[model samples]
Target: MKIRISWQGKEVEIESGSPGAVLVEAFGWKDPRPIAIRLGGELLDLHSPLNREGEVEPVFPEDPEALPVLRHTAAHVLAQAVKELFPEARLGIGPATEEGFYYDFEVPRPFTEEDLEAIEKKMKQIVKRCYPLRREELSKEEAERLFSERGETYKVELIREIPEDRVSVYRQGDFVDLCRGPHLPHTGMVKAFKLLSVAGAYWRGDERNPQLQRIYGTAFFDKEALKAYLERLEEAKRRDHRKLGRELELFSIEEEVGPGLILWHPKGAIVRKEIEDFWREEHLRRGYQLVYTPHIALRDLWKVSGHLDFYAENMFAPMEIDERAYQLKPMNCPFHILIYKSRKRSYREFPIRYCELGTVYRYERSGVLHGLLRVRGFTQDDAHIFCREDQLEEEIFRVLDLVVYFLSVFGFEEYQIYLSTRPEKYVGSEEIWEKAEGALAAALEKKGLSYEIDPGEGVFYGPKIDLKIRDVLGRFWQCSTIQVDFNIPERFDLSYIGPDNRPHRPIMIHRALLGSLERFFGVLIEHYAGAFPVWLAPVQAVVLTVADRHLPFAEEVQRELSRAGIRAELDARGERLGFKIREAQVKKIPYMVIIGDKEVEGRRLTVRTRKGENLELGLEEFCARVRREIAEKIVF
Candidate 1:
């Protein structure tokens, strides 16, 4: 049989499971292990017969595109293992994640560590059989019947949602699953895999849906690679922000307060204040005009903004006040638009930039509430720019520049940018959508920024550019977005008088450098492992007393540091120096200014850094160094 595949700018004839390389070789990775192959953006197993191939790229273990495929196959193996142990377990959607993969099942009870071990043993047995995965495509009606006969109601429900007449399912041995094409060649290919943990997840991520137990796991081509990944997982656990927040007395979510509502302790508040001060200063310097809006607005405002129609599910329920319905603010964009319409704008005021650190509320499900990362009430660094069509691209470029600058300030140098286009349900005309998308693309191109096109992932109102920053743990966190909208202006009848005194609709560009303060703060905690840089650290330095004899000196030193604009604290407790230093280390203080007898007599302070570097400097010199580092926003 002949296979039509593109290789080196020419068509080539090869059979299934053909040997391919050079994609990894080009990236300086010499991994020769083949897991799957990518043909025209779609992944296919090594043995899957190609009907029509454009270009096939072999996926190696070291390839960036291989983990999702491997982990997805591991999830199927996990499901098969679970089915062997509990034949009544009903399956849910199992999609691969950025880190690994997880599959949900409606089990009678949650799986335990013992269950995981038993499942792993069963998986090994299945792998030993070397079952070749067979893909079958049939009518959707037949697929529903097949799953319904097996009592897999969840699968039947999913099949009903598919708009296609035909659906595909994979079968390995006696196990069958409703899924799309492209998985590993056989069961034996799932070699090095481990079930990490189990958690409760709602089916379809909807709180109203049935609660299912999700089993999380990771897989790799080899054992050594799996070991390394497990090690990284351990590091990630150590850096978990929830644990650090409690241990450091930074923040908490109390039962008295609602879930996803953060109550910051003194230390956390200090850090937040510093972040706010810096943000305000930067925005003011960058030609931004700070504005404030009410916490609640009339329900009619949301209706006019289309939030009531398109975003009602996410918004909190409205309350009746003074015989009028009032809604809690979910977004600051509509208010900013109101501010624009407050005054009759002219061509001279084409680009009206309004910035605000606005606190907004949303009805987040309890099941999805995560520490500070996913919160119901959080402050967004939201800004809006109403500009003429000619100024749209340039304004977008400026926003991109600010986004990069803000992320870099927090030591995030790597980012994954995605340009999301129109979704299925959206406002605005096709011409306006195309123009808005074009402006964003032009700005990104002019800035020489590479991005992926996320099809049908934009908000209902507009196309947007989402910027996700990579933390130290190699995890990506969404922190910035730049969206362009023309429909909102039309909805509000926003117009600016042009050179000919004609009413021209002004294009609105919505931007947020730090998507939300709580989530960004959480990312920062994990990125630095709670050891903040001197600039952002709540306690920049702590004065440690060597003995009761050094109380006077320590007090004087801390006062001096505080007077010099450093956030310093004095630990004058009658405890051993080692104990005090250890406490300071636990708090992750950036500096430990130790005052002892010899140093007191010498009139010098022995400053030990968080990294354990000892520097003996005079009080004046130490203050100067701290000020320099703080002013320069030095990250270490």
Candidate 2:
């Protein structure tokens, strides 16, 4: 039968009995190399047999869909290489991730840097062989027997866990793995690959399971792309907030202070203050009323709100005070709900938007703690809106507008938006679900924003819209989330008397434009490579003395800049002027003002930017420029 393969604005017809065969033929063409094939919106391996006619699109390697495929194939290659090098190594699971791929193995010894190099060498050889990947099906019993005979206990265990009577496995040369695969035609397709590192991971991400050595690797379709990716990785490492935070004396996570808990130094606190000030100004301008809540609430409050039952695991262990259990808040929703229920409201006062930069605690797994990104205690820029059913769409539209405005101000213009509908086990009646989902959809449409609908991906209580902003390196971070909750209002028995003289439940919309302040700050640090915009920079300006004679002038200039609301500091560390300038550059300060005898005599200052450009200006002129840049939030 003839099958059509479409890719990169071109289509070709080939004779094949399976989709995989068609993909192999299409990939043979030089123009369509490094393509991802999908049949009727379902991704298929090049080895998958076609049972019916369907539309196919070949996604390029750079495409979002193709990244997973490339990384997955790289994982398979890594597994094959490990097996070839260590005959006794047993495979657990090898899956592709957002950054790359990792394969877990149960080996007698953990893999080291040398082992990674040797395995990489073996992988290159395997790729050169260009062995064809073939898929086969067998009965469950037969599959278990085959793997058991080969001493592959992990594979046999996995096969035993399969519920079906029959199972599929893929083979390349002598290496076989039980998988539901649409793999590449041959190993040689993985041309540019590198083994990144080795780490210990649980058998299936469960701490209770046996620890397995996981080898992480990444791959690309071509050498140039691989080089670019490596360069980006290096840049990201250099900009990592953990490193920058420590070197800049911003924050610290100490063993004595406990893990996943940040101790913000003066510098970090100053940055936080700036962020909070800006956030408050923007929220107020948007007509949001700010409120404060306690760090701990009675367990009964959470029980009534359904969090004690639903979110108990993530919550901190309860503490007993005055013979009653009180728990550190894991979320600000219930508190906000109680506040809404505190007083009688009316339809005329509908759409009450309340916001808070509330701090909460969670029991994060120890292994997953990474700087400020995943923390045990952090503040969320949380807000909740109580509105009538008729006002739901407008409230959501306003939140969407606020999200876009805030993200754009941070230089995140690109976004990936997802509108998630009800899950199968969700709360509320079907009618309520329909109304909530429709409101979210209407808001998106009203704003002229395109969003992907995620079927059955919502929380158990409500549907939601999640927004991911694209960073400079093309990585997306989930920042903004807006959820419509019909359950919370019902659980809390919240109502507002309408104009019709009837008490009606108000719709609750929960939103966090920046998600968690800590995680957002981490992303922001990496997004701008620690050289934040003028307004957001922790230290906007640094004043340096060219010599001892210029010390007084430098101090005066620093005071003036500080008075003008620029975060300025004076360098009096007895260091050379060149050294001070370099220190400012390393600290990522936007501006550096150098004071010298020439400038002091002329009652002027020498301005040096982070980019190393120097200009001579009067003290007043420099202060005015700095003030304007900060006020305007200029990128420079």
Candidate 3:
């Protein structure tokens, strides 16, 4: 078979009998260098035989899919280096991530920084060998026997789990791995790579399984590209929320309190209170009635909502209470449903909006718990709307409006949206599912928002729209979601009187604009690098004294600022004034008010902005300006 292909902007005819290497040479594709070939919507290494009779295009290093492919090959090289140095080690999975790749190995001891350096040196040596990555397929039994003979227990276990009769493997020199195809042609192509760090990981992410040492690394086609990524990694390390949280006295996770449970220090609590106050005000202004729910409920409630059937594994175990079973609440929707059904409703109450900052608990693995991003107990900015079908789109649009407003105020203007369709295990009927999906799509269209289709990613109950916001560092964080549920209303038989004087089921909408407050706060800390704006700053201003003579005036200034509702601190210690100012700067205070001899004599206030701008003002003027900034909720 023959097919037309494009290479270097030239159209040529090629036969399927030839391998990709022939095409690469025929087109002189070495300038940008085609590491892989794309044909029939599949990527193949340059040495692989091309069997597709279709238009083919060489995948250049600059293509979108090139980095991941390159990084996966780098992981293979890393594994090869490990084998060369430590022949007794057994390998685990090594997959490419968005930023890099990692490989796990079962070893007697954990790796050290020195080991990483040695592995890097060994990897460079193997790259010079230029061993071709040959792909092979064997029967399941044969694959298991091969790995078993090599003492690769992990590979044998994985091979047995494969339902396919045959399994694919890749080989480079003497190193072989159970993997799919689409690897680099050879090891010499491995360049511009770095071995990042090492950590312990369980087999298949299960804690009960044997733990393996995981090494993470990244690669780029060119040195300059790799340099830019390393710089970004450095910036990310500096902005890591965990480090900022402790240094700024914002929050912490204690050994006694348990992992994934954030204990907000005094300063952190102040910031949280400010965020919650704004959330409450906006929710109330949007016609949402605030409500509360208990932290624990009867076990029967979850069974009725289908959480037990589909989400039991993620839920905590139940406890005995008064000869009955009680479970911690993993969600707030069921409680809101019960609240709606507490009384009879009329058509006049067609649209019911209930919002809650309800704290819920779920069982999260200790290994996966991040600082404040992933926690077992956290408060959700959850709201549910019960309305007629006609009002569905409008309610969805309104929720989107609120979501955009909140994000914009928080200085997050870049975001990605996704429309998720029903899952295979969804509760609703096919027709209802389609209708719900269409309704969400229509709402997105009406809002003039573009979203990608995330197939089969919706909740087990319904379709949803998820908004992931991009931080200042260009990192994406999942923050908000809106879901259209038909199952909950049907399960609870929620009804309202219609114009025809008959009971009509109202459609339910579940929305969480901020997902979890804890996670959002963590994102905010990183986004602003722990220098919260004046409105959210725990100590918006601090009054500093230049000398002992200014102590009386400093007390007066601090009292004045505090009376005007400014979160201020007075640094009247005998320490040097420069030291006080430096400490305040480290604390990330937005403004520093100087009470010096000149200011005291003039009965005036001298303010130094966080950015180092100074201004002189009367007592009333300073208070007015501070209040205005707070009222405006200005984002720095």
Candidate 4:
């Protein structure tokens, strides 16, 4: 028999056998880098046999689609090493993540640092052995029997869930795993890898299920790439918000209060206030009416908004109050909808925007909660716009512009925007969904912005435009979202008198410029490394005296700054000027006004910036310069 292989618009006839044969003849055998074959759009093992003609493409190491495959192979290698080290270890699921891979195991005890070291050593040995990975297809009954004999209860359970009678499994040396895989030819292909850390994870992310030990690891195509990744990881550790939150005395999460609830310190609260004041002023200037709502509302309100049915999992349990059930608000949409319904509106009032810094509560899993990013209670910079159908596109354009402005002001110049369409189980009609999606796309195009379509990732109620800001370290944070909702308006019976003098449904747009103040603050902390710009800094300037005699002079300078609306402080401690300067630096203060005998006598201020720039100027000159820098929100 003959088989034809077509690649890059070229075709060749070869004797029927494995695709690996053609690749070896065309390229070479056992190349060091990750190289695989994609047959008719399905990724396949290079050794996968081909008995018929098909279009083939080579997946190189640099291809974006190849990293998941490489990481998955590394996961298999990790499992093999674990089984070798501890023969009694049983496996759970191992999957590839965005950054790397992780494998769960049901071991006698949690893995220790020493155990990870041993497992990594054994993985290296397996790579040296270059054991070939072979795939096998077996009937469900046979697969269950195979795993049962090996005491792999997890594998047996997994097999039972497979609908198809035939299941695929991969084996290397004495290790076997139930998987539908397109792995590398052998273990040697994984050139550079590292075992990062281990943590306890409930099976399948359910709190009711038994917890398993999960080992996280990463792999790269070469050693230098791996080295670069490790260095970035180190820098990330140095910028970790949790560490800096404490070291800089910004915020804290205390067990006495509760998990996922942040206790903002004085300095942190000052920063938050600055952000809130700026946000409110900008919204007011842009035609938004600020409003306030209660933290808890009657449960029927949620039912009307569809949150009770669709979002109950993330909501707190209901509290019964005087024969009525009340729930902590998980969102501000319902209240805003109620506000619109309070009075009959007119088309002339179209594009009515209501914004609030509303605090909301949700029940987050304890294990998944971080310091401030994944908090249970957070204040959202929430807004909702009610507009006519014809105004939808223009309103979206305005929201996108506002989102970009807010992110840019916070020093986020690079971002990734995604337009998410309707999901499978959605509330609105298909016609409305298509219209909303088209409006979002049109707005993006009108603004000359490029965005990717995230199919089936939108909320059940609406389509949305999600903006992810890339910080200084090249990490992305989901901060801003603009969603077009038709369901809530219909559910709430929100209507406006149109030009025809008839009541028509007003489409609602839900927006959050900063998704949550706590999360955004955490991102800001890490993004700027706690060295906030002067406008956002809690203490913009600190006055320090060179000697006890200059205390009066330092106090006067600080008072003048405070009068000028700058957040200034006076460090009047009985320590040396260098010690005081170091303390101010540690606090990440933007400016330091040093007063020595010469400056005190001359009635001048010596200004030192956080970046170590110094300038000797008259008091008035220094204040003017500082005000300009703060007003401009300069980075450094």
Candidate 5:
């Protein structure tokens, strides 16, 4: 049969009986391997037979589809190695995640560092053995019996939970797993693999379920790619925000203070204040009206907004006040919606943009919390745009432009944008969903930007456009989102008078350029390795005196820099020049103005950059250079 395969924009036709068979043959060609196969509108398995003509796209290794396959196969290799070594370990779920793959196992003891090393060694051996992977279909009863005969109770339990009568199992050598898979053809296909770390995870991700030891691992298609990834991981570790936060005395999460709660020290607060100032200026420039909302609102407000019913799980528990219940705001959408409903609006005033650095709270799972990246209380750089249907595309384009501009300022040039369409359980009407999704797509296309369409990956309320910024280590973080919500206006009964003087529901566009201030700050720390740009740096410059005689000059220079709006301080402590320089470098200060008797007498200051470059300049000239760099927001 003839089949058409299209990817990105290219298309080709091949004759084959099955998708996998066709790919196996096509792999011999110089074409990129498909990560997924789309037969008609359905995502079909690579192993599924193609009996008729249809469109197919090959998802290559760089495609998102390949990540899941690589991660899933890595999980299988992990399981096989575990069974070979421990023999008594009970398997639970092994699935691929956005970052990597993880497998949960109930073992007699938690996996030690040495145990992980051994397991990794065995996995390498399995990869070297080049065992062929074969899939077999069996009735649910037979699958359960087969697993039961092998004393794999977890596999039997998993099979029992399956609603289908038939199940698929993949076997390689002596190990077999009950999985619906399109795994690699053989173990040797896993070229670059590494076991990340071991952690405790609940079976099926349910807290009430028994906790199992989870082994996390990541794999790549080639050895060189793997080495690069490993190096990136090392760099990421060195740039970890948590480590930097502690070292720089920026923030703290105390055991007594509570988990998922951050205590911003003076240094951290300075950074935060600078960020807020920049945000306010940018929003004002972009025609956004800044608004402040309360941290807590009546419980009924959320109920009216539908968040209490639909988003209750993520919300913190309600508290009683004067025999009435109140809830901590989990999101700023409801508050912003209330602001729009406060007064009647005309069509001329339809596109009302309200922006806020709103602090919200959510009850995140304990095990999932990671420093500032995942927290309970965080501030969202949120904005809502209320506009007519005709203005939707223009507004989306504006938002997209703003996101690109803001991210570029932070040195985030590479981004992975995803436009998500309506899900099966979405609230909006089909026509509305279509119109909103089309507007987002049109905006992306108009800007000549490429984005992936995530069908059925949208929010329950409406479709959304998500932007993931690629960090220095090449990892993507979901930092920006622009969602079109038709349900909120309807549920809240929001309306604005149209050109015809008829009341019409305003199209609400919810957006967060930097999803959360706390999370974004963490990403920023890692992205720049704690050495912020002069414009955003908490302490942009430090004046270090070489000796007691230079202390007066250092203080004078510090005052001069401070007057020029640079965050400069004098290091007048009883320490040697080398110690002071070392201290400034450790703090990642962008610039250090070193003053000694020789330089002070000559009316010059020795300049040292964070990257270890040194220069000597007149005091007045140095100030001019610093001012220009700060004004320009130079990144180094």
Candidate 6:
């Protein structure tokens, strides 16, 4: 049969055979970079026959889609190498991840560092052999028989669960794996690869299943790219929030306190207070009514909010309070909704905005908890806007404006925004969904901001807009979310008197500018490497005396800065000036005010910034400069 395919902006017709044959004819069999083909928007194996005519695009190493394909193939190769090294090893599923690939194996024992080294050597040998990968389709009975004969119980179990009678398997050398693959032509194509680490994982991610040894690895097409990635990984390790948190004495997660619960130290508490103070003032200035809510409420509240039905997994067990069940608040939305229902409102009071730095508790798996980023208890900078239908779009516009302003204030200027649409299970009607989605889209367009549509990824109650802020290391953290909910107001029977004096449903918009203060602080720690700006720093400046005689002057300097409202500390620990300055730098204090004999005699302060820029100025002048920096929230 003949097929029309698009290649390099040109369409051509050719007599089709195998996809590999067609592609080789178009872009040469010797072209090493084109490893796969995209047809009908699905990545396909080159060896598969072109049974139908369709538009096709070549998958190159540099393309975004190529990384997963490359990593998937690398995973297969890893499995192959493991089987070769240990003939009795049984394979579980192997999949590609955003950063790399990992494969789980049911081995006799957990893999060790030496085992990883040996596996790496075997993988290199496999790559050098240049074994061509081949695909084979089989009936379910045949696949079952093949895996059963090889004693591959996991493979047999997988094949038995296939709904369809047909299954596909790929083979390279003497190794075979059940997969739907578009792997590279030969093993040698994976030029640069590294086995990252080994960890234990349960099959299918279930604790009830047999545990398997999971080996993590990454592959790049070129050596330089691999080197750069490794360097980035090292830098990320150095900037890890948990490490910085301990070193800076910012926060802690204690076993005695319980996992996933953060204990904010004095320094960390100061930073959090600053963030909350800023949040409260800005919200008040922007016409938001600051309100407070209880940490736990009657279970009936959550049931009405649909948390019991839809989000029970993330919710903590209910408490029997006075013989009535009460649940720890997993969300602040229901509480905010109750506040709106407490008052009778008119259209003139439309767009009634209520905000809270509300602390919430959710049950998170211990294994998933990571420092403050993933925690059971966190305070959300949450707000809800109850408005008329006509005010929906304007409210959303305002929310987006606030999101940008909030993120930018923390030195996060780069962001990716997504408009998430209705999911399969939703509470609202099609008309409401359409209107809410349209309103969100209009707000984005009105602001001249571009966003991608995340199809069917919205919360069950409504469509939403999610904002992910990219940090200094180019890592994206999901921080802001603006959801348009028509269901909750209807569920709560919320109403406002219109101009016609009729009771109408007020649209509820749930938004969080900084998702959770705990997670946001974690991101900030890593983004700035714990060297917060002058405004956000726990200790903005340190006063260090050069000698015992200089203590009075240093204390005086500290008093002046404290009087000027700077978070300054005086280091009169009888330590050497150089040692004290080094300690201040280690704590990431933004400025160090030096008090020595010369500076005291001159009535001047010798200031050294964290970046090592030195300046000589009067104590008052230095204090004024710092005040301006803090007032302006200068990043440096």
Clashes of each: 0, 4, 0, 0, 3, 0
- Candidate 2 C-alpha lDDT tens digits along 1-636: 776666555666766555455564654644656444677888877677665555676656666787677777778889999999999998898888877889999999889889989999999999999987787889999999999988888888889889999998889899988888767778888889888889888876677888899888888878898899899999889989999889887889999989999999887787788788989999999889999999998888888888878888788899999999999999898988878888999899978999999999999877678998999999999999999888888999999999998888789889999999999898899998999999999999999999999999999989999999999989899999999988888888999998998998898999999998889988988888888888887888888887787888778888888888788888877888788888889988888887888888888877888887888888788888878887877753
**Candidate 6 has which clashing residue pairs, if any?**
none
List all candidate RMSDs to the true structure: 3.7, 3.1, 2.0, 1.9, 3.8, 2.0
User: Which consecutive 10 residues in model 3 have the weakest lDDT in total?
Assistant: 3-12
List, residue by residue over 337-394, the lDDT tens digit for candidate 1.
Answer: 9988898899997678999999999989899899999999999999999998889889
- Tell me the lDDT of model 3 at 443: 84
Taking all chains together, each candidate's TM-score versus the true structure is: 0.93, 0.93, 0.96, 0.96, 0.91, 0.96
Runs of candidate 4 exceeding 4 Å displacement: 1-4, 12-22, 26-34, 49-53
lDDT by residue (1-636, candidate 6, tens digit) is 787777666676776655554676675545554788888788886766576667777778888888888889899999999999998999999999988999999999889999999999999999999988888889999999988988899999999999998998999999999998878878998779999999888888676789899999999988898999999889989999999999999999999999999999999999998899999999999999999999999999988988888899899999997999999999999989888888799999877999999999998766568899999999999999999888899999999998898888899999899999999989878998999999999999998889999999999889999999999878899999999887788788999999999998888999999999999999999999999998899999998887889888888888989999999998888877789888999999999988888988998999999999999999889989999998887885
lDDT of 5 by residue, 1-636 (tens): 677665445565776555454654554433654545655655444655566655555556776567677678789999999999999999998988866788999998899999999999999999899876666789998999999988888889888889998998888899999988867767887878899999998787678887899999888887787788888888989999999999998899999989999999998899888789878999999899999999998999998888878889899999999999999999898889888888889999858999999999999888889999999999999999999999999999999999988888788999999999989898868999999999999999998889999999999888999999998788899999999998889998899888798998889999999899999999999998898888888898999887788877788888888888888988888888899899999999989998888888898988999999999998788888989987777776
Off by over 4 Å in 2: 1-19, 22-37, 52-67
Question: CA shift at 82, candidate 1, in angstroms?
Answer: 0.8
Give the TM-score comparing model 1 with the true structure, all chains together.
0.93
Worst 10 residues of 2 by lDDT: 27-36
Off by over 4 Å in 6: 1-17, 26-33
Return whichever of 5 and 6 wins on TM-score.
6
What TM-score does model 4 achieve against the real structure? 0.96
State which candidate has the highest lDDT.
Answer: 3
- Report the error of model 1 at residue 249, Å: 1.1
Candidate 3 vs. true structure, TM-score: 0.96
